[model samples]
Target: MLQNEQEYIRILRSRLEGTMPHEELDDYLSDYREHFRIGKANGKTDGELWQSLGSPDNVAREIRVTHLVKKAEGNRSARNIFHAAFATLGLGLFNLVFVLVPFILLVVMLLMIFIVGVLFAIIGPVAFVFSLLQGGLPAFSSWISPLIGFFFCTGMTTFGLLMVIGDYYLARFFYHVGIQYLKWNISVITGTECSA
Candidate 1:
């Protein structure tokens, strides 16, 4: 049989009950309930209201994804972030290129910069030591003057450290922007009349 308002609410509650807190879930469901009530008042049947809202399952999935992403942003854990990204990726095929590929590239680039930063930070001291020991250890000697080597190493160290710091802020900025984008995508691209 085609679902009615109660059935629709039951399905949504079943899907979201365990994953989200009660208050939040209630707040979320209230929007749908209001939709149904308004539709009925306007002389629409339950089936029509349900159809306009789209599939209950799709609505639940969108809510789940949004909640998970919000949770990840609040707590900031790797697992949470991965789950959010993965959920976002599951939204559609377009996300494979627009979301997944960019996310992967961003993670790789951040890690590379962080590793390079740490390497240069460590190498700077080692190189300074090498320049100092050049007279005794020919192999350790730098081709440039010790003074020039000192400045170069110092600059590299500073630049690398700055890169890492900048990358961290960039990650945070992207995280916020990503959440906004996901919210928009879920609302606009989900093939449903989303509740405001």
Candidate 2:
């Protein structure tokens, strides 16, 4: 179906209006209007400009991803990044393999490490108490001296804290890297332009 200038703007507005701030939405619309005005001045029709820019839906999808990615970067929140990643996935089916699978694996790995860190942090104090009590934990009290156990528990707690801290830094690193990758993917790997 052929789209006129009005149809193109309408489609973009419909898809993206609620998802971003009004100023941003107006900026996008203004840019498209400029493109149309320039094209028309050069003796090109609305259809030609629309075709060059690609279908409004695909273009809107790109805009949404860009908006969400910027939000993620600005806020550094997991929810924002997650929304951006999923929006990137919407650009094409190949992203199911290229983006989603790796994202899931990375998230699971991070979560596992976090859980292990928390378990160690909790167990250290529990084991410390057992090691000190009269009827302490059977295995630890039987073989370990109280002073040694105290040191061991302290070491365990410290290691856990370090792990937790490391995990946080690692997550930040991944988040930064992921945002860059998503920017590249949306521009180079996904449909930066489309036809209608």
Q: Which candidate is the best by TM-score?
A: 2
Whole-model Cα lDDT of every candidate shown, in order: 0.77, 0.80
Q: Residue by residue across 30-129, what tens digits does model 1's lDDT show?
A: 9889999999999999998898889998888889889888978898987667667766667567677777897888888878878887887777767777
lDDT of 2 by residue, 46-137 (tens): 88888899999989888988888888799987766767776776745767788898899999999999999988888888888876785444
Consecutive 10-residue window with the lowest summed lDDT within model 2? 187-196
How many clashing pairs per prediction, in order?
0, 0
Query: Could you tell me the TM-score of candidate 2?
Result: 0.55
TM-scores vs. true structure, each candidate: 0.49, 0.55
Question: Global CA lDDT of candidate 2, please?
Answer: 0.80
Model 1 residue runs over 4 Å out of place are 1-9, 13-92, 136-145, 191-196
Residue pairs in candidate 2 whose N, alpha carbon or C atoms collide under 3 angstroms: none
